[model samples]
Target: MPARPHSPCVEAAPNGSFFHPDVKEAFMNAVTTEIPALAHDAGVPPAPPEAHRTADELRDIPLKRLVASPYNVRRVPPTGIKELALNIWKVGLLQNLIVHPMKVGARKAQTFGAAAGERRRLALIYLFEHDYIPADHPVRCRVVPVEDAVLLSATENEMREPMHPADACDAYRILVEAGRSIEEIADLYGVHPKTVQRRLKLARVSPKLVDLFRTGEVKLDQMQALALSDSHDEQEAAWFDAEPYNRDAHAIRRRFVRDEQSFVSNRVAKFVGVEAFEAAGGAVRRDLFSAAEDAWYRDHALMLRLATEQLEALGASVLAEGWAWVKAMPERDHATRSQFRPVLPRRTEPTDEVAKELAAIDQRLAEIAAQWEADDMDDEVAERLELEEGALSMRQDEIEGSLLVYHPDDMAQAGALLSLDANGEPVIERGLVAREPVAAATTESGENGDDDDDDSSDGRPARVAAPAVKPTKGPHSERLMLRLNAHRTAAVAAALAQQPHVAHAALVHRLLAGEYGHSTEASALDVTFRDHSHNLTKHAPELDDDLAFTMRREQRRVWGGVIPNDSDALLRWLIEQTDERLLLILAQYVAASVDSVRPDERPHAINALIPALGLNLADAWQPTKAGYFDHVSKDRIVDVVSAAVSPSDAMRVAKLKKGDAATEAERLIAGRGWLPEHFAKAEVVRMKLWDVPAKASDAEASADEAEADEPALAVSADDVRDDAAVAEGEGMPPRD
Candidate 1:
């Protein structure tokens, strides 16, 4: 073959006689394409040459001879390099670095520059500096051609995804299960010990919840809440019981453990003291991941027992003080022990020296107050003065306390009551005399005609006959009154449902109450309705377990579920809703805030308004054992039965036990449209629309005008009917 001249694609430089022209193109054209076909015909395809070296090749390269490439895609921070160094020292290099032979000047020694793993090279340098590894120690690396090293580095750094959190947790768990310490695992992975522990904790969560987390059904924070409990049953139950919107971390935590545990910060718990309760074998659950104060004590029964025992022990001294009797109670309420009259403690004059000290304290307090008023004091001076004032006040209190003592005679006749104060401290109410004995003495005096004497040497007050007047109607039993009010409230709700204009006016009344009234005294009619029903839950020990509260809570939950979650969506839905549906919602709100009783100032107003609204109390209310009949006295139960059915039926149950009588009364009045005096229509001065307060009327008038001007949209009338029925406890569907 004859030699050919160079192609024009590669031209000669101006100064040079000759230069390579189109060398690459010439080379490609010169090579024959039949090589692969010839190999295939021979029943074997030619093997492609390797583009890059594998990790196995060039494994033994000296650390001193390896230098970091200037064009590395990833850079390791200085602190990260130190941590990486420690990890490499502990576990050795697990991944091989990619490197290529570096082209150096004549003065420099031959060395390999890292292409893909600059962090590993830096870590090796750090090890050498720390004397953990020799400068010339050999490291494992995969060597590639210099021209291809940058591509390999970019691919290695960018192509791979970080490990998924669940997978990482599982891996940590596997290591922990294989007898590796948390510290050891942390060091190997270049993370904190807490990080490793958290991952391991996450791995131990209920398997089903873990699956949910992996599938994105549950979030990481929710998973953390589920991990709070080791019991899979509680975890699974919380997940299932929580509504979709209520599946937040806090809600999950509350649902998981609130019922089973009581916080140490509770009044009863503080009174009992966590130390003493724990001493008595009551277990406390503490969250290691949370703050120290965030702990709960389990076994409420045991805690209560410990508290009662402690209270009794403390009350022993009071009982020994010649008291007629000593009563110990968990809380101090006026109603519980109001029948006993408390004897005032006799105040004795302080000793001359003590009196002088008190006078000096008073003088010092006066001086400080005068100085504070006269001078523009700095904060430090003011703080010092405050401390001095507090100290003097405490001293005065101590002196006053020491001077007061109970008389022996009074202590003999009166009793002591021990109770926990609001701050959970033991308070002794001393010298309380029985009202029954006082009343008996008065009765005996009347019988003996000694009540006429205004002056008696015995120090007892003379009794006088009360002025005669026409007898007023006796009050109904509390249960009966509550049942009556419930009926009235239902009637009010139904009446409001039929009239949207009145409903709108009532809503305006609530809005004005909230806007003009104090925040603490704001009307309860703002959201739903406010009724006396919640009062029944206030004193109940098991508030969450109460039938009424539970039922009401579930109803609220259903209401919440149907409401739009997004604010804009809710606005749109409200805008599109019909007047009847809106009225039905507003009626529920208005009916809840009704307070039509004698003591309330606006009772006559509500009474007059009820008739105008056509509220049918009998049709809206029915008494049930749980809601009413069971809580009444046996005589009251008999009275209710007598009023509803017959006197014979009342007499039939009068001889039975209270529970049995109540049950009978409930059955007798099951479907009867019986209502108490409070719910019945009464004669009262009619209230005009102008009777509303001037300020309130103006606000309401504006609101009414606005509502009237707004156009109403179409809504399902069936929906309004369903809501009214639900509110009145009539034909509501069973909750899921």
Candidate 2:
């Protein structure tokens, strides 16, 4: 690659530099090459034999005329339509869509059904609808008869073999070596430059590993893993060191990342900014193959120490603000803070000047709201108006909120928490009062017999004293418990989705087992599941790194890759899936919809499957100062500590300040297999059957799982025969 003018996108790399100079040169060379063959390799049908038609036969047909055909056999929707659309929009369509003349009503204009290239036609339509392309965007197409069109469509999807990964990588390498640029190759192949870069890297893996891939001894994923490292020796070492059965793609990747902290995902690393770490002389390793959201931080201790120092500095400032104490914790999850009481700000009315500003802002907001209700507005105009309204409303709120300040007495009693937030910025939680002694619990809410009823609800005693009632009941108010329940429910749903057998069992129990003889509705199934991702994320943002969250994310990715976009195609495609595959996805969807997050009740039905699903809430969640203990009474923390550790340990922590007790409880509870009592599995003697040996039936019902495949769905040929009628109504003329 020759020198070029600077580009800001170039500075976005993890290491603040683009690829190696050699890789840059290769990308430059690949960019210059024609990519017609690459596009053909990627699902576009090859040109027909010249003997069938002249060059004139291949014509530019309007996109609207190139409608989808019913006879196009590939029912499964291909993934990446938006990506494909963007590529076509940028470089124009490469391959001709195989279209056939369709029979239509006498009054209707002539049109063609795209039998072979439905995906490309859809891409063109997407572009046109988005105004990226003209209203009548011309799609390059080959005119064929009805029977030939069907044959071409089926053959292009089924008969044409995709280029082998090994061959494709080698081809990319050759192009790069022959002075082609990545942009040119990406444009020709309808892919991102990074994709070409990935292929080139794959080609550069240990030649021996490439040979293994060629011989089918190594899989494509495994090859991709080995390509993570540039050193051929390191790649070979990783390959040789792996035990045969353990040599999966993830395993290979783990071998490389074993010692390094996942900086992107690790909260502490985010808290200690990347540049700060580097300035502190810490080493960072950027993975060139992956999207650089975060790189491998080489020194874990250094990262932690850096975070601690920053937090400590922030604590000093908080303490100076007259807080009784300032606690600086490294973790972003402040679950333990649930036990602490929050001191209310003294809400003396705003000053005259601030009050005037607030009134003016509120008046403007009312005017904007009235205008919004009265007028039908353009999207841009509405957006602009909405923004102005939001700004005014925010200004009003700011003025009012500023009046509610920490009173001198409240600050004298309450401490502050100086720690990292989710985004890694240091934030100080003010007016935090550690739980007062048990004697003070009745009046410790700082209300002094105040107006708000909810204020009196704070810091209810977690448990009774030496008489020792079961400590599971927490001191949290109903509303806060509901929030916790929402998070837990989301986690359970995620867990349930991963275990198809358990999900199936839950379904069966709900529909049959519970109805027949079971006394309790302990199955957790409401007989329906809905994707509550949006709701759950809004309620519990901390669930972002949760195992359940990750599992659901992966599930979405997997489904997106194979499922067709068309509803008709989806039905056909689903009908075609294997029993196991169908059951797996069914379990995921069903599990996702499960919601037992209620403060009034424990998740008994959902918890019953804990052992069966091997659901570990401990792994998914941790008690933190802010997230858990802060919302509950200090006694709850002590109760948990006692149950998880010992009575002596609980007593020891009980003597400390509520915040300190919570922090201590978190430490004691770590790796103790203790979760919030609501998550505990309930004892169940369920599923009484109407017939068969009672003991045998009960034993079978209680068994961990039945791996039996779901019965195959039988689709009558009659169902498919009517597809042509359905196709006709959906833009396609009567191609049959």
Best by lDDT: 2
Residue lDDT tens for model 2, 1-736: 9898876534433322233345444543543243324333444444334322432257888877776665565668877778889887767787888876665556876677677888888888888888887867777888764434444565577777888888998999999899989998887667889889888888899889999998999998888778767789889988886567557775677667666777786778888877898999987755556656447777888887888888888788778888899877776443556557666665566678887887788788778878888556889989899899888877865665566667798788889877665566676777878775555423212323532333113332111111111225546766666667667667678777777887887787677533332223334665546455545554565765465575685555446434665789899999998888788888887776676555543324455555566656676677776577767788888888888899998887776667666656776787776766555533332222232222357557444123111222222222434534854764411111
Clashes per candidate (backbone, < 3 Å): 3, 34
Check candidate 1 and list the clashing pairs.
Answer: 10-21, 10-22, 530-592
Runs with alpha carbons beyond 4 Å of true place in candidate 2: 1-71, 75-82, 89-93, 103-111, 125-140, 145-147, 166-204, 264-267, 274-282, 286-295, 300-309, 312-316, 319-736
TM-score top scorer = 1
Candidate 2 shows a clash count of: 34
Q: Please identify model 1 stretches exceeding 4 Å from their true place.
A: 1-90, 97-154, 176-201, 204-209, 228-258, 269-298, 309-360, 368-736
TM-score of 1: 0.43
CA lDDT of each candidate?
0.61, 0.66
**Candidate 1 colliding pairs, count:** 3
